[model samples]
Structure formats: C-alpha cells, structure tokens
Target: MTAIPVSAITIVGLGPGSMDDLTLEARRVLAQAAHDKQTVYFRTIIHPTVEPLKQDLPELRIESFDRLYDESDDWSSLYQQIATEVCDLALQHPIVYVVPGHPLVGETSVQLVLEQARKRGITTRIVSGLSFIEPVCNLLALDPFEVGAQIIDATNLAISHIDEVAGKIIPTIPLMIVQVYNRRLASEVKLALGECYPDEWPVKLVRAAGVGEEEAVLEMPLYELDRNNFANHLSTLYVPPVPELSALRLPETLRYITMRLRREPDGCPWDRQQTHDSLKRYVIEETYEVVEALEENDMDKLAEELGDLLLQVYLHSEVARQADEFTLGDVYEHVNAKLIRRHPHVFGTVEVDNSSQVVQNWEAIKKQERASAGVDVHNESVLDRVPQATPALMVAQEYQKRVIKTGFEFTSLQDVYAKLEEELEEIKQAASPEEQLEEIGDLLFMVAKLAGFLKVDAEEALRLANRKFRRRFQTMESLAREEERPLTSYSRPEWEKLWARAKEAIASN
Candidate 1:
C-alpha cells in the first residue's frame, strides 16, 4: 500500500444504505477518520446509514454533497466539479470519501476522483463495500456467475446504441440493469431492449434492495416497465435468460455458421478458398440481385436476395477475421457510431423541418467529424468516397450529386442540356480517335447529370432501353423465321418491314 500521509485520501462505500451490509474494514476506516478528526465527506447523506454513522461517530464532521445534485443541471459537469473538489481537499488533509455503493462499480465521481488524484500525485486508498448487485442477486435467488449475468447502467442503455451484441446484451444470459433513475429512462431502456427482446417478456424491477425502507420487487411485462411510479436512483432491472434459442438471441449463430464453413478441415473447398478479393464478385452480384428484387416489387424475392447479400457480408468479414484484419463487431460499430453522430435530429436535441435539412445537417456533421479527426476534408475531392467499382452511370450521377453540395453544379436541367449539346458538337468535330473518345465520355456524363436532374435512375433507364431493344430484335427474328427466311438473309427493306411490325406489336400490347 502507498504510505498514508496528511494528504492521503481513503475512499469508502456505505453499502446500499444498510448498516449490516457495511463491511468491517469500511466501518473501521470511518471510525478512525472520526477519532483522528479527519475530514469525512459523503457524496450524499440520503442513505439509511447516515444517521446511524452520525450516532456511532459523534466526533465525525461528515460533509455531504446532496445539494449539488439539485444545484447542477449537467450530471457530467457536476461529477467533474466534485472530483476537483475532492482532490483539492485531499491535498490539505487526510480524508475519507464515502458514497452509497462500491466506489468502483457505477460511481462516475469515484472514477473521476481517481483520475484527478493520480494526475496531481495524491495517494489514494480503496475500502470496498457491498454494492447493490449483491442484494439484487439474493433477491433473484440466482448466482450471477452461474447464470452468466451481464450488468449494465441504464443511463448508457438509454442514450447510446449498442453495436457489440444483440438485444444490447449477451444472449443466453441474465442481465442486470442498474441506475434507472426515472420513468423516462426506464421507458427508453425498454424501447432499446425491445429491439432484441419481446415486448411481452417478463422483467423484474427491484428498488431499494437491502434497505430498511420497503424494498419493492415487481414482475411485469417489459412493455409496462414505465407504467408504475416506482423508479428511483436505487432502482434496477433484471432480465431473465431466454428459455429457447432464437434468431434474436444471438448474432453468434451467423458467426458460428461462418466459422464451421472455413474452420472445419472437411469444409467445402469453395468456401475455404475464398479471400476478400475472391469474394468481391459475389458481393457485387448479390447487391444487384437485391436491387433487382426491389425493382420488381417482390417482397419474397427481396427477402431471399437480402439473405444472400448478408451471406456475402459474413463471408468477407470471416475472411478478414481469419487474416487478423478485423472482427464483424468492428464493422457494425463503425456504422452505428456514424448513424448516431450524423442524425442529431434523432439521437440528440437538434430539430429539423424536412429530409432536405437532415441531408444538409448530415453533411455538416460529417465535415465536423472529419475536422475533429485532424482531416482536411475541404482539400479532398468531393467525389472521393464514391467507390470506383460502382456502375459508371451510377458513379456519374453521384459525382453530380456531390459536386452540387459543393456549390459547383448546374442549377437546372437547361444548363445540363446545354452542356450535353456542346459535348455532342465537340465529339462530332474531333479529328483524333482519342479526342472523340474523350468527348463521347463527356457527353454521356452530361446525359447522366440531366437524368439525375429529372429525378430518374440513369443506370436503370439504360437497362430498360437495353431490354426493349432485345425484345424487339427477338420478335423481328421470329417474324423472319415464320416467313421461311433467315434474319441475315433479309434485305434492308424486308428487315425494316419486320422491325416496324415488331414495334407495332409491342405498342399494341
């Protein structure tokens, strides 16, 4: 242990407000601090043991910060200021810092105190006490270790999106949610958890566990968590382990499937041989199929195509994981963080009028994020993130879309049409093949920008034109065959007659 000095600080927990729950060492530290006339400060004096401690240590001058909770609007800043005060007071005298539960568990102030104290070269000591988790386990009649319990703070569950696991928790395990300080927070927790757990699933709410004042334990459907008015600082939630396996239970099922395909010695050779580069074609293929299903307006086909697309993701991710590049969790974390950070209208207090404003705000947020990461994004090309592998027509449209955001695009389709006409004239006047090629490409790009201005999908438009031509030509060939003449044997006049009839046939249909 570090040598105790006049500047040393001893931190203790009051053990969930029950006198019997306080450990012997914690009590001894309080007694010694009182006997020596050292400063003893309680983070809050609202605990049941506060009066008992006052009677036991009559000489102790215990200061309380209960009023700070009411005085400060921001809990983060409040905890920060308290930590500064604790470190400053410790420098002048040996002190005892007491809080309601174990100092290391869910106490933000204690963490800040340790960080500040360490930076100032102050000696610190910890005397652990019983935390609310112990009594909660007792009430549940279950061993946390045996049940594979996962404990989380309700505050974190309320504000942040969970990306590492399903249901915001590990599956096949019990979960203990602590620090549910109000009904609003309880409702938020229930909503976030509802993504992974059924709304009708039973959940237990425990309040003031091991305290003298009545401990309330209520079992209700998860949907009703915010209905009753039993929430307080001491409230906690218990989610029992799922009885049967489910898709929502774990994402690990997909991970396991991928693992067996690649890890087993007798696995399919095609799967075992796939690398990131080798699987790229399948990723692109599956994505286009999904798009095709959407274009056809078929939900059944869309679902099957979506699964195939997911398979591509799992295969590529597993390949990278095997190569020690990254895990699948890293993929979702990147996207989840981007979603929360970009959509301030949802996750934060920012308000907006329409989707247009949301798009502008998203770009602004992305720029700010880049600046924070020490990137000079203003110097980078506006089309830098558009993938090279994307379809050429789609890429062209995206280029025009992004450039418009930078205030450097045609204001209307009239300007796009003018550019297209100018490029077509340039292509016709070109002497060299290279010059003609360059001008032709420019003309196509202008065409794509015009399509974008008209709110049309340039790529899909080209696909439809290609389909129409193929269908007409096939009909022409069939007419030639019916007339006992090969399509190649037809004269220009005969071919024209067949093509006109084919067009008339399709137009009539």
Candidate 2:
C-alpha cells in the first residue's frame, strides 16, 4: 500500500452571498487549487456564492460533513469530530476548505481545524473574505466601530454571560447575536437577556443577510421573542440598547398574594387547616430565608424568599380576618400608617439626623400612641414589653438592650464578663440538677447580653459558632477515618489532637 503524500491545508473564505463579495485572494486560491488538481472542500455549499460556483467547478468536492452535524445531538462534539476529520484529510492530500464569509470570523470549525493542523506540523493558510457582519452592517447602515458591536453565538447564551455583556458593552451600542437557530434557543436567549434588559426591549431578527430572497427584518419586544416564528440557522438576533431597570417587585408581590389565595379555605386542605400557632415556625423559617438571601446577595432568591415571608404575613392577616379582627388589607393599612407615623422626618415636620435618633423618636411616638389607644404603658421592668414568643436568646438580648438604654446595666464589657463568670461558678456550685440548670440559663442570658453590648445579634452569632463547631468536628471525624479509627473509639486526648489538626487545617485554608 502506498502512503499518500501529506498536503498543505488552505482555508478559503467564500464571502457573503455574491461572487462580488469574495476577496481577490480567496478567488485566486480557489482557482489555483482547481488548476493544481487539488481537492476543494466546502464547509457548507448552502451559501448563495458557493451555490453558483458549483456549476463552474463540477469536480469541486464539497465537504458535506452536514451528516456529522446532523447525526450528533451535541453541537460541540460534532464540531470537534468535524475538525478532526478535516485535519486528518489535510494530512493525506492538498485540500482547499471553503467556508461562508471570513473563515476567521465566527467559524469555530475553521479555528479547530487550524489549531489541530498546527499541532500535527501541517502547514495551513487562511484566505480572508468579506464577513456577513460587514454586509449586515451595510444593510442596516450601521458603523461597526463608531456605534460599537458585540458578536455573540446565540447557542452560548447564559444568564451570567448575558449579564457580563450588558455590563461591559455600552448601552448606546448595538449587539449582533448570530446562530439563533430555533424557537427554544431563542426563548432561552430572551430569558438570559430579560435579566439585564426590559421585557419590552426592542429586538430585530434578521435572516439570510445579502441573499436575494432574504426575508425582511422582523421586529418584536424581548419578552415576545418566542412568539416570532421565523428564527433559523442563518438568522441573527439584533438587540438595540436598553436603559430602563426591569421592574421586579410587582410580579413578586402578585405571586405572594396568589399563593395565599391558593392556600385559603376553598383551596389546599393542608393550608386551610393551618392557624397562627401552627404556622408560627413557618414565619421564623421565612425570616431566616430572607436573611440568607440578603447575606448571599441573591436578588432572585431574595425576591422569592421575600414572597414566602410576605405569605406568612398575609397568612396571619387572613386568620385574623376569619376571626373578624383584621383583613389582609387592614394589616397593610396599619403597617403603612405605622411606617409613615414613625418616620416623622419623612411624613411630618420632625427633623432627625441619623437612624438612632429616628428610632428614639419612633419609640417615643409608639409609647404615646399605645397610651392613647388604651394600651398599658406603665411597664416597670426592662423585660416587661419583650414578646414571650421571641426566641430566648433574642428576648434576653432585647431585655439587656432596654436596661442599658435606661443606664441601669453593667458599666463595661469587663462587668458583663465578670457576671458570666459568676454565673458559671454558681452552676459549678449547684447542689442539684435543677439548680444547675437554672444557673446555666443565667449564664446563657449573661452571654447573650454581652453579645448584644458588642453589637452582635446573639441568635445569629450562636448559629454561626454552632456551624463552625460542626464543620470542625466533621473534619476531625474524617481524619479519624483516615487513621482507620472510629470517632466514638477515640480517647479524649486523641480526639483533641485531631480537633486541633482540624482547626489548624481550617485556619490555613
């Protein structure tokens, strides 16, 4: 068997649609390759320019690796296979690979082939031709440089990528997105874009640019992208710059209200049976979710969790409405009025410099209002007003904060620390389990007070410490497993060694 001599790879750019659009260099290379009896391959002969050339060059072996693309479900895998095959063919014989427009522009297959050929020590030449971008720009009367343009593959649309493009690209500049292909892909593209651009943002869908039977430009709002039925492989999505901030609150509020209605007496049985007492834990859970959302800086999750939290409020309000106490509307009206009343600086003539002063003013106004409403105002103890339903740590912290405000608390951090130490000593000296438990509670209360004085939320501080301890202990357990020992079988001294190692590892990280 005779081994075929390896041939140089020539990438020819067919330019857009017409032969007039083809560069002199691209035409020269194609003609020369034909004259030399070299095999000519078209990446895609579907282009109008390449369609006419088929007649002049009957022997031009067009690369219809379309079957490779058609057979593979994954485009990336197909592209890789196509590039590999082209490079293998180039290694065997001199080949002229023809691609639509500039081979260097938006041609991933050409890029792959060139890269693979380079690795195989195969000589490769790229003949540049007029790209579809230039022709599209001409058709739209757009200046690519002056207006600025971003060319993105439609298939690669993702929320984060769209956000990055929106952030970097100036809003005044137009964006040209190529290879939209289908409605599902178009919808995905729209959803990604919807995060940055408004739902009503104008987008132009252009198909078959520079071709004679080219369809007229179709216009639609960004939200109605899927509604446009003319999207295809040769289509491009053009998005004009948007300046408006997307309204995110209204839909969230609607969702909250709808969920509550769905769970009403005439709705879900589980939800209908729920009362204020039964749903108490849900309120606390939703509040924590809101805190988590805020901590994570996740606006979408925050919006969702906030809706859950709102549902709790509306749930309680609906229960109250059943008992003829208050309706959901009444709950809103009360809170809205309370906020306006409390922020006298905003709703009234009262002037306040900072948040602290505003809080003080609010408390003062609340005391006066409670007295007028025939509510008790002669609360003697600092802890008297604290809600019994609140978590023990939070209640203790609130009691301490109230006492400190009245200048009837510990003088300094040292004083609070000494009190905690005293409680610990009492716990150690306790004669019975009941006495010990009481002392331990006292100790915890003092610790919560100290945490409050330090401007730390006692509940959250404890929760974080609990999480850290669990993580460290888990690491210790894993280390024990590595040592072929169970955590339960380890002695105190051995456990301490592993725990220390875990802490050290955590600190190092």
Candidate 3:
C-alpha cells in the first residue's frame, strides 16, 4: 500500500448506502488511516453503510459532523466552517473526509473542502464511488439521457427566482432533485415548481435508494409533496417531464413553433414567402388591434390581441434569422441590455427624485451610448429618434415634445390657443389648392402641439372622437329606419332633429 501523503486531504465517497458498495481503493485508504492511527471524518454518519463500515474496520477512529448540523444556523456557512476545519486539520497531518456517494455529487461540504484546500495550496485526492443517482434511476427504470433528465440540488430548486423558473425547472425534461432532507425544504421546492407546474402534475419520492429492503418509492401528485413525512436525509424527488403539448406555456415553445412554421418543404407556403418588409403592415395592424382591445377594456381580447402582436414580432424575427441578419435572442439581449444600461437609478448607484429625473438620466445615457458607438451625437437631432412610420398625430406630438425641451414652444396656454387659431384661419383663407393643403397640414400639426401642452395623447383623443362619430351615425341610421325614411332623403331640418335625438339617446344610454 502507498503511504498517505503528509499535509494532504483525501476525500472518499462511500457508495450509496450499503457495505458491499465500498470500492477497494476506499477500503484500503480507510485501513491505512486506521493503521496510521489517524481519525477519519464523516460528513455525516446518517447512512446505513456507516455502521457496517465501522464494524468492518474496528480499529479506525471515527469523527462525524452530525453535531455541526444541529449547531450551525446557516447550512452554507456551516459547510464552509466544516471545510475550514478539514483544511486546518490537513495542515497538521493527512486527513480523510468521507462523504455519501461521490465527493462531487450532491455533497456541498466536500466541494467546499476541495475549494478551500486548493486555496490553501494543500494537496488533495478524490476516491470515486457510486452516487445516489444510479440507484434512484434504477428504481424509476428510465435512462437519464433518454429522458433528458436534469439533476439539481433541492435548495437551489427551492429558492429559484420565480421569474426565471422556466429556465431553472424545464417542464419538458425529467428532473431529479437531491437532498430533500426535510419537510420545509420539500415545501419550498414545491412552491417554486408551482410557478410553472400544475398541482396535478405527477412526481415521485424515493427514500433510502440502494439500501436493499429499506428502499421505497412513493408516487404522488405534486401538490402533496410536502404533505407526506417520508422525507429523510437519503430522500430524492423525481419530477417526470410534462407532456410536450402542455409545454406551450414556455417561451421556447413559441420559438419552436415559429421556426417550424418557416421550415423548408413542409412549412406554410404563405409564411415561407413572407419577408421583413412584407410583415411590417401586419405588425402595425396587430398593434392597433391591441390598442383597440385596451381602449375597449376587454382583458381577454387584450390578451388575444397581444398574442397576435407577438406573432408578428416572431414572424419578422424568423425572417431576419433566415437571412442571418440577427435572431430573436439578439433582439431580447439588445433590449434587456439597453433597459439595464439606461435605468441607472434602478440598476446602478445613481439616484433620482422622480420619473422626470429618470427620463433626464435616460436621455443622457442614450447620448453617451450613441457617442460610444461612433454616432454623430453632436449633429443628431432629438426628433430623429421618433419613427416616421408612426401615426401622423403621434409623430407630430413627439416632434413637438422634443422641440419644447429646447424652449421652442409657446410660453403659455393662451399663446398655444392663439397659434392654433392662427393656423385654423390660415387654412380657411388659403387662396390656392396647394396653399390650402399646406395650411391644413399646419393646422393639424398645431392641434397636435396643443394636445401635448394639455397633457393628452393626440392619437387616443382622435380615436375616441372617431369612435363617437361612428356610434352616433349608426344611431341616426337606426332612427331613420324607425321613421321609415331613407337616410339620404332626410331634409336639413329633419337631419338636425335626427342628430339631436341620436345624441340624446347615446347620452342616456
């Protein structure tokens, strides 16, 4: 047998819960430690294999960190402390740290010890053994690779960010969560998974795997995960993959659907023929439908319309992806980065008093970004950021808002009204058709500017006006039908009376 190195840490893996599972190298190392009168440290002596190993090696001195578990407040810090103590002991003499299963698998203290030992410049060695994953997988009778299984620590799955839960616990893959050592941890894990998985989703609890007759597997719905008392230090939770059709809630599902719709030969012919330029009008139309849903205050309609708008975005992105210009991932990355970079008060140490200050900071950061990107910041107009393809009223309002920041706006409401009236009169007094068109355009521009000063959305106001006119005209048609007279045959007096009646009926309703 090779003599143990001085001032080194040897971590041994005690194969999952059976005396016969011990590897020859691990047994030799333990015998050597016993012969050398060195104490072997067990991360925890809570496994069925511990007693059998102790019986086999009667002369071996054993020390367990079971007391540390009861004494320490924080598990992370406790693991670090255990690592520190092991490294400190290695500095005095060679130390053996025996952990359940593989030192690298589900053993936090073992990992911590390895890291701390490396930092302290201490020589370290690992003795591999069968991890709990093998026996658990055997009991389930499924190949991990075939099922696209993912293994994660219970603690990580428990405290996973709710918003990022999709990326953490994918529903389309089988999940094996280790170290569900207590009811509390199981409960937290259940809540985290509840974000994406339904309560009726089936899952399994396996206890004392590879421990012969002591092993048990309990199949239950996800909602009952924390309701049972079968959890122990040797327990693992298995979450089967959700059905492929049920994975529609995932963003990747949308991406996949979009890509499949554009796939060659079998793809939708119309979708295959679409280009970015051809899809622009669809995007605009879907956006208006979303606005219409919002204006009507129908949440269900809003959700459906928003999905249509999202489809347009996906279609355009797929087109760009086919051309190899950029991808949906690039779009997300660019926008997410821009949001974080511009919102200094939220993401950085910069302070602000209100949203006004936030807007100021946003513009300043944008200017800095433009300068860094070699854009002509000094020569660029503020109005250049507003898209020309936007609705005419919105474009006009945006232009006015931008220019007003430079003190080019009217000083007061009276001045704004005066300018509006001036433009209106000029349109009426125009001498030629060309002059009349120019004056009318100026009048509408002035109206949009007036809307900005009055703190109203010009586009929404115009939409509301258009809706009111349509509703009142339809009411007039109804009134005309009731009186048995054609709408076109109504005299001026009769038309005035019908309009008044329609306005009153709508107001009463």
Please report the candidate that would top TM-score against the real structure: 3
Question: TM-scores for all candidates?
Answer: 0.57, 0.50, 0.78
**Better by lDDT, candidate 2 or 1:** 1
Candidate 1 lDDT at 196 equals: 71
Report the candidate with higher TM-score, 1 versus 2: 1
- Model 3, range 13-101, lDDT digits (tens) per residue? 99889888889888888989888888999988898988887788888999988787678655447677889999999999888999988
Q: What lDDT score is found at residue 227 in candidate 1?
A: 91
Better of 1 and 3 by lDDT: 3
Give the lowest summed-lDDT range of ten residues in model 3.
Answer: 69-78
Q: lDDT (CA) for every model shown?
A: 0.83, 0.75, 0.87
Note the clash tally of each candidate: 0, 0, 0
Ranking by lDDT: 3, 1, 2
Q: lDDT by residue for model 1 over 347-449, one digit each (tens)?
A: 9999999999998898888889888999888697887879899999999999988888778878777888888899999999999999988999999998898
Where model 1 places Cα greater than 4 Å from the true spot, the runs are 1-7, 36-39, 71-78, 91-93, 161-168, 212-216, 243-253, 256-282, 289-308, 315-509
* TM-score of model 3 vs. true structure: 0.78
User: Whose lDDT is higher: candidate 2's or candidate 3's?
Assistant: 3
Model 1 residue 163 lDDT?
52
